[model samples]
Target: MMLEYLPLAVVAIVGVPLALAALTRRGDRALTRLALALFDGWVADRGRRQRERRELLYEVHLEDTYRMYASKTLLYAGLVALAGSVVGVYLAAGVLALFKISPETVRATLPQQLWFLADLLVFPDLSLGELFTLLAFSSATLGVAGGAITYWIRWENLSYRANARARQIDESIARTVAFFYALSRSGMAFPEIMRSLARNRSVYGETAEEVAVAVKSMDYAGLDMLSAIERLADRTPSQKFREFTDNLASVLQSGQSIPAYLDDQYERYREDAEAEQEAFLELLATLAEAYVSVFVVAPLLFITILVIMGLMAIGRTLPLLRVIAYFAVPLANVGFIIYLDSITESLRATREAREIDAAPGLLAGVRRTDDPDADRTGTERPAVEGSAVRSDGGERPAADSSAGLAFERLAAFERVRWLRDLLSNPARTLRENPVYVLYATVPLGVLSVVLRAWPHLVAGTLTVETLDDFVVQAALVVVGSFAVVQELHRRRIDAIEAAVPDFLDRLASVNEAGMSIVESLERVADTELGALDAEVERLRTDMAWGVEARTALYRLEDRIDAPVITRVTTLLGNAMHASSDLARVLRIAADEAQDTRRLKRKRRQEMVTYVVIIYLAFVVFLVIIGSLNSILIPSLPTGAAAPDTGGAISGGPLAGISEVDVEAYTLLFFHTALVQALFSGLVAGQMGETSVKNGAKHAAVMLAIAYAVFLLLP
Candidate 1:
């Protein structure tokens, strides 16, 4: 009977997802609509506490209402449970057909002790009641499992997003404070400064993201600035952000001097950011020691003891060592990498992108009042207004110039121009994102692996131990190339950022010397500002092409994508709108950049020692593994050469002596070193440079040593 419904099941399987996918083309809101239609009665209405809790949860990061987004999440969970139930039924049928247990057939060969077990599981025939019971049990079990999985995912995803934002906010808040403080100094109102920050989320990261919600509430919900600030405090996940906003709300509510408060906050947060970075560096040092002791020393001891136990025939432990070397160690290394990344999150820079104006571009239709060019072109008085008045009391827009169409064309090209430039020059593209190097390296690495591996496969000699050398070599090839290129990219950015403070100081000096911004740029462009000189020239070129100074600075930010650079550009760009004393703003930006660089340089110097310790620890780990494989194992007594004495020593221990598999132990040790090399390098990179990508060279060197040591081993 169920077989008759199988085709319908198949159709439902295909159609439901296809229908959902069709809804996606309408935008994300389409799902919200569909989910509400299906589940609004249950999900939309909630108790007061749930409404409040989920309101806080859904507002900031998700940018959606609890009613809509919650409904969508619940609906997805139910669909997954439904699908799981269908799968359970099908699996129940499969089990019944495949197992088809019978008591008599097993009873003759089975013991009386196991009779109850056979009787319990045996199904003489697939009766209706029996089928229904089995299907119901399986369906209930799996349906609950699926529902739990989806529910966990929903909460986990929300929490992860919240935590990520918290991290981003903590990392970028110092710079964000400086940004608004600069605005305040420029005589911009606090409300306008908040609006500016909201509009520039790309530059400020999660700080701006939080403020953007408040700006929206102000726009759409008719909330005052103080109300929005309070709401922001309530909604933010970061404790730091909450405290900052709470204080800001207090300042706004009280009738205090906002600029003075902001200036003090900016200086305080800058020092706090530095202090926090120092703490992070200390944490990295601690993690480095922990990694070495756990991954290096601990494994060395365990492998040594396991080899000794196998030699004495106390336990057959070759496979255990193999599992430790090949499976457990590498997995733990990856975990360490994730741990490094999470801990370093508070220290990393945010480089998120935000869009600015692309409308009514440089090609605006402005008919000059006394233009000789328009007169020569026979169009002396083309209406520059969006519309023109006609005698019939109807509006007649200019037929001669379509500024909107021109702006649209320019915007269309601007979107793809970066892609075109990337295609035109592959090197710059790779430099922009080192991961792109994998596009070329992966294929080459794979081909080399296949060439080496194909021979082993044909000879029926393929095994992990045999292929370890080849696989690690391929990893080295792939990872080494990426690391080299990644380092180059990092260094390029570093060199450019290093010059930023000097460049800003020089620009300030020139501005204070009475040159206009353009004149200052021309003046500074004549004297080299190191790697930044070229970028300043680019900015100058963009301005020469009639771009606004603010937009040109924004372009410079977009291109540089550095930490201090983003803050500086955002500060300069927004300050120009609110103040005439740009020289003061420039000096402030330069000081901020200089302080950030100073902190980073100190952190780098401190971590260099930890990085060296990691390398030395890794070497010590290898030497221990090497000594065990060579001297200790080779020196141990084999069962074949055990003393034939009837003494207590021989009777208790030597009597159980057995020959160890030296070949397997050596292979495991070799592979263990490789795994250590791979992850230790990543840890070292994270410690020294605050990036795992910087670890590639370290990993390559470790891998080379392991390969050479193993090749020379018996």
Candidate 2:
């Protein structure tokens, strides 16, 4: 009887050996080898034949298929077969049980009994043996088909994952090859570079794995460098990486200077990356416009229409329309939200691309360069042109003799009395050049006054609100002018701060070259370095013009107000008065300035996280409020509340409150919008180091969001 359902019989017989084979193979090399051999000879052969005949289009690679089946296919197939057999046996027993047949009778007729039960389960009214026989045959066929389909789906998924991993590996290899090329230019010997890279493999991702393979090939198998690299490239599936390796091999064979070649390549890459970033930024600007249109303008237009319709039917249709408006507005907002999310993700990708483009330059700057001989000497000789100079007679002096003449000229130029006179009196300088200050502050003051007065003028209350308007307008003008003045002052301070470090470094260099502090300053002041030169000239002029050094530095500090300048002036002032270590003090000031700049950069970076968090929090708030108003609130019974007229309660649970004033809520919404704008401005200022005025753009966006949400609400 079991022979009648031979597919089922086969399953039952093979199931145990498959399960035993799986258990035996674990920690048993003999069993594993046997399984692998069988899979290769049988299963893989079948797959190949099937592929050849085009019976299967997505053919699994023979090696991969062999590995999969040998490791777990047997156990899985056995489980499938065992499950089918158990089901079949249960059906047959149930059939026999239903028939009121004795166990002795069924013992002699297991297949007939199972067939009867299968028939009963499949078709309850059917005759016992006929239905069972048909069902048993169908069950056996179905069980095999189901198992095959499951395995096929699983295998396809595995293949997909493997392909993805291979692509990732390829990209990793390309990046690693580029890195090694860069390192080679840094004067690292080929083998030493490889060794160092291999030691820090984890940082390079999957390329590290390839490096391990190459190291093994060379160290253990005695393969040469070319063979090892070629083998590694072959093992990797990345076209870019293969091209890089081949190029390297060509270079190695041609005996070209690797550093020069790498430098050229790096420059080319940098240009390409910058061009890509420019294109991306252009794309981002377009995307930003699209986002603004979809999320801001479109939503606002819809809300405006809804508001107009509500106002038109203020006495009659508004109650029902308001309820409908709540639901409709929020549902419409979903489209805007989806658009925003898409735009945000696109922006994130663009940002990542920018970072990636910047990475090579950053790495190049930090990477050790090829200058071992220079490093050992502790001093590098200047180029011939840099050492040569023109004498007073306009003839070029020999490089070895021009240093003293340069110093003398520098000292004479530094003694300009007018420069020091100017530094000691910045107010006089500004009063004399009032055009720059007037050009900056006048427009800001006028704009502020106009904006503050426009509201009163629009209401046709110029006469009645004269005092109030005047106060507001005057306040606006004062604040605006103050802000502009502060910005201008800050710019000047920044210019001074930027020049201080370089100036100090140069001064130290000249001092170390055996010049006195005064001579070093005098030398540097006369150089044509613009702001630094001007500042140093001012100091020398102060000394020449009979202004005390202490008074002159204090005047410089008062004009600039940068911390670095303040410290520099204090140190120089103290040294001038107290005979302190002026050189040591100048060095300390330079170090402090550098440290401060570093800290500022670090603080800005840290604040970026907070800025991001604030933006995300706002987005989350919008989404939550949107979801509640659109989906949940509208679903509630009270959501259908009718608009209130003069003291009448109309619809839903909030009928009483409906008659009460909602002017407070309206005011709250407007204030919330303003608050959102304020924080957005703050966030922009903290993260971007932009002026609060520039932050108005971000503030405008946040305000638009808040206003849109308020207008969209029921």
Candidate 3:
């Protein structure tokens, strides 16, 4: 009965739209205006509600909500909706036509085909008009659903953007508070400082935006700097920001020394930041280990078990196992990869948050004060006062401070320090520089290659066919030698850099004591008490062998490339040609070197999180690959194979290749090994704080592990 009336229904639906268009020809403008106003009010109300909730829940400031969609966005959205509706209608009509036309033929030739077509279209066996009616209903339903989903997502995105803006405002307030505190300490008037902040808002990032607002408030509303700051803080969503502003307000009201308070706060911020970084690093290390176990060890173990089981059950193997191993394995591995990436990104975000939270301290450290030298008075004063006496006397030498002490306290456990340094050396460099050890290992590589290929050679089958095996085996040995040599060189460089700083400081001190720079270098070289002493002695030898002092120092700089060494050398070389204040120059150089060292330490701390993440990612990659090979791939039917080549090679040396497509399998194994090596090396290089060459060792290790496992697998 419904089918008989479908044509009439379709006509009525088409007629109604035309009828409505005829009646509302001239009122579209008024209707559109009214609709837009309502929409605007609705959005504003929603925003207000959201702001209220955010304020209540997180102590956020409620900024005025503005309409997110501009006319352009609305126009684009309308265009997209219209296009989607047209596409949807066309598709529905096509599907309905297919269903209606194919029913008789499909039912006659293949009943299942009819059912499949019916399932897809949701209806079948209808006239053209009836099909049109069904198409109209289905297309409208789908188009509306899609449009609504898209709108909802866009709306949610707008809200998220608003929240982010609010957070940015809060961050700005916090930074401004810090800046004002710094300026106030430096004796800048409150109002003048606010103006300065306004002028340089761009430099402050998001914090500058709040400072701009404060400046505007003062200029336009007749509010003082303090009152404007209080208002800004009140409107900010950050609790830390609010607290900082409140403290600033109190300090301003009391007229206390802003500098002293800022200094104290800066130190506190540094300590807190350091603590957060330390925690993040600790978590990162744990994560790295977890990833290694899950990705590397677990996969290897599972693959090993699967291979063993498959080998043992060769005669009884089911076809389904191959399907599972190939298809299932790859898919599962892909899924695990996605999961690992998501986890890594999440952890990275958390780490970044921790870093950002520590920004106050970073800003404090950068803030310059007029009396910058005052903070260093305690340490610098003694050096300054004693300089003249030491310079004139040239007898009572500067005492070796505790800072000069090198390698005190040997381990009770019999020197594990060397072992630590060895492990800490970049692994990739060690692999790439295998030539350093090639002289020692060339014979061994030849032997391993010969021994491994002995069977084929002994059978008078030693031809080009077997050469690849020998070459591969020998290459591995060569690679191993390169790794060992690189390790040796890295250890030497680390020892030199570690000792260069204090050595330079001592040299500077000796130079300050009226000793010629050359004599100072000789004196430190003669001490023969530390790693730097040895390096200096090497320099002295070069000098004794007719090398100029400047040239020898330059050579040392080239070898070590330590920034401290470079700066000190540059200073000494310049002072040698100038009749300037050598003592002051040396002092300044030492201080700069110390600062560089401090910065380096901070950078290392920051990188620790990234290092851990890279390692974790590698581990996850390994686990996923392992799961694929061990479980998924083996389960697939396509992967299943017979043990023999149907007696084609029942009694030849080529039997192994015949029984399996050994060439293909070997190629696949090699490819996998190479990729694993490349990425593993990259991760190891990043983690080990060494060059990419250092990463080669990690790549080699992973490659070796992978190849061994694959070879051992049945």
Candidates 1 and 2 compared by lDDT, better number? 1
* Candidate structures ordered by TM-score, highest first: 1, 3, 2
**Residue-wise C-alpha lDDT for candidate 3, range 87-139, written one tens digit per residue:** 56767766656565444565454333235654354464678888777767776
The weakest ten consecutive residues by lDDT in model 3 span 349-358
Model 2, span 1-714: residue lDDT tens: 866567556666756555565477453444456556555454544566444322212121233334544344543544575566556655665655577555456545543324454433332345878767756765576567656765666456545544543444443442344445445533457765565455434334445555666777888999988788777665544454556667767777789887566555544544443454345345444543553454334544543454333333232333443443344434444443344343222111010000000012111111121333111111122224533455664655344335345434434654663477567885555433433444655676567667766887898766523533344344334433444444455556556667787787777778767776667767888766555566677777755555444555555554443556754554454344333235544554565456445544544464455445545555654564454345543442331454434333342223433232234324422443334344444334423332343243455456556656655666
TM-score of 2: 0.34
Q: Give the range of the ten consecutive residues with the poorest summed lDDT in model 1.
A: 370-379
Encode model 1's per-residue lDDT on 644-697: one tens digit a residue: 555764545444455556677777788788889888888888778778888888
The segments of candidate 1 whose C-alpha lies over 4 angstroms from its true place after superposition are 1-168, 187-189, 238-240, 250-257, 350-433, 453-466, 637-659
Q: Which ten residues in a row have the lowest lDDT in candidate 2?
A: 349-358
Count of backbone collisions in candidate 3: 34
For each candidate in turn, give its C-alpha RMSD to the true structure in angstroms: 8.4, 22.8, 18.3
Residue 478 in model 3: shift from native, Å? Answer: 17
Quote the positional error of residue 483 for candidate 1 in Å: 2.8
What C-alpha lDDT, on a 0 to 100 scale, does residue 178 get in candidate 1? 82
TM-score to native of every candidate shown? 0.72, 0.34, 0.41
lDDT of 3: 0.51
